[model samples]
Target chain A: MSVAHWMQYLPIEIYVAWRYMRFNLKQSFIVALAVGIGVSIIIFIPSINLSFFGYFLEKTVESNAHIKVVRELDTEARNRQTLKTLYPDEGRILVSDQSLTRRRDIKAYKNLVSEIMRIDGITTAAPYVSESVIIVRGSQTRTSTMRGILPEAEKNISNIEENIQQGSLDTLSDDQVILGWRLADELGVNVGNRIQLLTNFGKKSLKVSALSNTGIYQQDLSTILVTLDTAQALLNMPNEVTGIGLKVRDMYQAENLARLIARTFDLKTTSWMEDNAVFLDQIRMFRVIIAFISFLIVFAAASSITSILIMVVASKSKDIGILKAMGTPPNAIMRMFLLQAIILSLIGVVAGIGGATFLIELYNATPYSKAETFLGIGRQPVTLNLEYTVYAIFYATLSSILASLIPAWQAGKLDPVEAINQ
Target chain B: MIQTDTILQTIALTKVYEGIQPVYAVRDLDLTIPQGSFMSIIGPSGSGKSTLMNMLGLLDRPSSGSLKYMGEPTETWEEKRRSQFRNEEIGFIFQAHLLLPEFTALENVLIPLQIGRNLSPARIEHAKSLLDRIGLGDRMHHRPPELSGGQNQRVAIARALVNTPSIVFADEPTGALDSTTSRSVYDLMREINREEKVTFVIVTHERELAGKTDRVITLLDGRLQSDEAPKESPS
Candidate 1:
């Protein structure tokens, strides 16, 4: 038969199925509730996880460079020397004399930066020098890592300018430095206060020009920023850079782009994701576990639907017999029950999505402090993703259809004579 | 044109139940039912009247021999073909009325047409007219559970006639009704048979009801005892 002709038969099946469900409202409600709970969990857990991870990812990516290109250390000589010491009589090591020479800086970093910027998806590139230094203010002394950067170039890659709490990065001169808010507090110094900075070369007195707080405890505790020229002059290294920081338009592509840059430039590169792989893996694991648990709940809900359908089929055997005697085809009988399942599942899925959405909105509307404590974040962390809701409904419908198949088949296969007799 | 009057014929039809000890539910029954005929098969308990009805109604296959409808042998037909034939050409009414309680009286009458996929508005109106003619016009909206036993039986009768089948097999259709209700139901069936020229085969244990039909066939111990018209003497 043509599909249109088959479609013509569906209304009667649907009507009968709807009538049956309406007749047994209590059982239908119970089955729908079970499916609703299952669908709610399916929607809730994933959406919250996405929100939590999305929030943290935004913070982490904004606070740091998306990709970092560093000078590759000459480790071959050291590794070979250790191997020789460990296995002296094993063999002769085919080590090249060139391995002993260490390349401590990237040559033509300006050109390299321009070349990297030409690559698709790379937004900005900035070169900087990073080293450990000691800060002295009166009798107080603290060791901190200092980064030397061109203020204008640094603005493109990092959010330091926006994070500056006092003074301004644009006004920084060669004789001035920026300190983290907590670092300046530990030194008992404010902006415009002269503080002595000690490097491997010698001590230089520089004025603290700005203080910044990036809302991260570790960064605010011990970090100082200075101009690249002054840092090069202090370390007696001219026309050289220690590393280059890059920002990419697509943060998720950072890892692959970092690997590409490493292969292209023969330099060591690390993306933010690689630096925090363990935490990302943990989040992924949690998502998978949540999905599995949600699947189990849906399966349980499907079982409940199955049992209810079986009971209805068993109780309605006489009706089935009469229908058969009336010449209702076997397929129509099956379709009637399947239609009931689809309708019940649709109701449950809609209710579940609505309930989950309301709960999400309620969670987000609560006080920040309470929500922060509950979600372990600085703000609410539950985003309502319509895609997950669609997925939940789709799976619920599929499970419900599958659950009703056996019972519906049995009903379709019933012997009319025996059923009528019973 | 002269059309054959034999609507159904059975030749030495037998049905055997195989169990711990095999029992013959029907044995060596040869019968013919003419078009537009109103007949009753009557028998005592265990006389296989119900089994014979089931075989004749296409609800069960005979164990041996041939059963034909309109001169076409039915034993070789597929289940789908048989069901289609049954839907288009046959109707059945059981003792319990067997109306789907979920459906109203009108919907119950339309059940056969609905299954046949011919439920146009005209057919629906015809169903309503059938109910109206059966004295159920005002109660067309009531479900079977809400209707009296006799009213439900009338609905069943309307349902049986909805498809306008060639033959309707009613198995003790008024068994659950009172004597007065039973007489009324029989009168309705006789009126439909005469007006529509539709054949009807009724199965009953009540001899009085059997005596009312044009022809009566009696079964005893799975065998035909007699087939004749009722005597005029009032026993």
Candidate 2:
């Protein structure tokens, strides 16, 4: 049929459906309400899951580099006889073919980065130096993991500058450190304020250069960023970086790239997804359990609709008989009854979606407080998503269609002879 | 021209119900009804009058018979074909009036036309005219339960004629009404028959009603006892 013709046919179908529903007002309302609530819950839960997943991703990315390079650390740094044996005599940093060494000291880090960049789909590689240091602003001092990087090269590997609030990466050259927003707030320091940094080897006073605010509250508040050269000098690890952070073209491709890099380097490399497998699995498992519970709601609503249809079939037996006697076909009679169920379900679904949208909007607008905070922190804002509306409508539509099938079949099977006799 | 005389014809029509012992509700009955005729089938409660009426109305299929309407064989007809035939050519009224209580009087009258015919303004006007003719013009918007028993039956008659069926089957149509109301309903049926020249086959247990018809067929134990023309006209 042409779309126009089908569109024209809709009103008659609706009228027929409306009349059928109007025949039993109470039954229709009950079924519609039950189905509506079922659809609302189904839609609301998925949205919350997606937001929570978003929160989890942000935190994982903040804690680690885009890709961490794993390699063996040198055991003995400074015994001249052992250094000659391990580092090689004829201008080589190391003699092992498994390691990529540079003829010159500067070329060693460059060689490592160049080798990593040669891998297909590897976007950028940069050296990252890290060490645990005490950040002291007067008498108020806190233990923190200080990470240092080459600002320009690190841009490709991390979102350090993007996360900084009060200062830029250029501030690192003036013996300055970028602190997480929470850590800076706790220290009561502003941009250009001086703070003393103490490592195991020595102590140096650095200016508070930036307040970094990433949504990952713990990492945002606790970690500090400094220059890789300065970190190496202060921590007494000269001409050495702790690890190299590498970037891939896609975040999702991290695990695959990590595995390939691990094989090439002959070292253990863990991807972000692998590191946070338990958390993601918990979210997935929770979604499955909640979705199953939502299915029960749909089932209850569908059962109620079925019961209404059954009752309508029973109560309207005489009318059905009259129609049959007037030569109404079994299929037509079935369609009339089935149309009633579809009508009820459609109304319920539409109302549910509308109601759920309103409620979700209200929830998103209103601030929600958690009784116990996440990560030993206080409650934060609730996030609502549009995708939940789509999910709810989709599930409701499927459930309604499924609910009408048995009733339609039963109506079709009614014997006109027996029905009229009753 | 196609012959109009044999509007209805049956050859050895039989309907048997299966049970511990099978019951023969209608047995080997051969009957024919001509166009523009008024006929009544009369019998006691179990004499198979209703079963015969149901078969004639196409509401129930006979177990073994050659039932034909307008010269077309009905034994092998599919559901849609049967429905089309019934929709355009057969009308039925039952004992309980069976007016859908939710619909107004006019809507009830328009049900068959709306279901079967390609409805236009004229068809709707015709329904209104039928309602007005049945003295329900002012009550056209009232629901069946809101109206009296007699008024509800009148709505049923209006619905029956809405499609302009060639024949109407009435199975104890006046069974629920008082005698006075029954007479009035029968009067309306007779008036419509005379005016429209439509055939009517009324199934009733009342002998007085059977006596008033142009002809009567009597059944006893699923067997035809008599088929006689009325000796006198209705008073």
Task: Tell me the TM-score of model 2.
Answer: 0.82
Report the C-alpha lDDT of model 1 over B126-228, residue by residue, as the tens digit.
8888888999999998998899999999899889888888999999988999999998999999998888888989999998888889899999988999999
Q: Estimate, for each residue in A1-422, the C-alpha lDDT of model 2 and write its tens digit.
A: 11122222243334456777876788889988987888777776665666656665765565456677655423223333455776576345444432333211222566677888899888877787777899899889999898878988887566666777766876568387888888988999888798988997999898887788866778877878888877887877776677787777777788999988777765456677787788878877987887788878888888887777778778887777666666667777777766776677778888887766777677667765655546433333445456666666677667776777777677666777687777
Error of 2 at A26 (Å): 2.3
Q: What is the TM-score of chain B alone in each candidate?
A: 0.96, 0.96
What local distance difference test score does each model get?
A: 0.85, 0.77
Tens digits of per-residue lDDT for model 2, B1-235: 1249889999999999999999998899999899888999999999999999878877779999889987777989887887777878888887765887877887777767656744666777888899899999999889998999999999999999998889999988899999999999999999999989788999999988888899899998887889989888562
Candidate 2, after superposition: displacement of residue A278 in Å?
1.3
Q: What is the two-chain DockQ of model 2?
A: 0.40
Native-referenced DockQ of model 1: 0.52
Q: For residues A307-415, what per-residue lDDT tens digits would candidate 1 score against the true structure?
A: 9999999999999988887788888899999989999999999899888888888887877653333222376558887777888988999999999999899999998
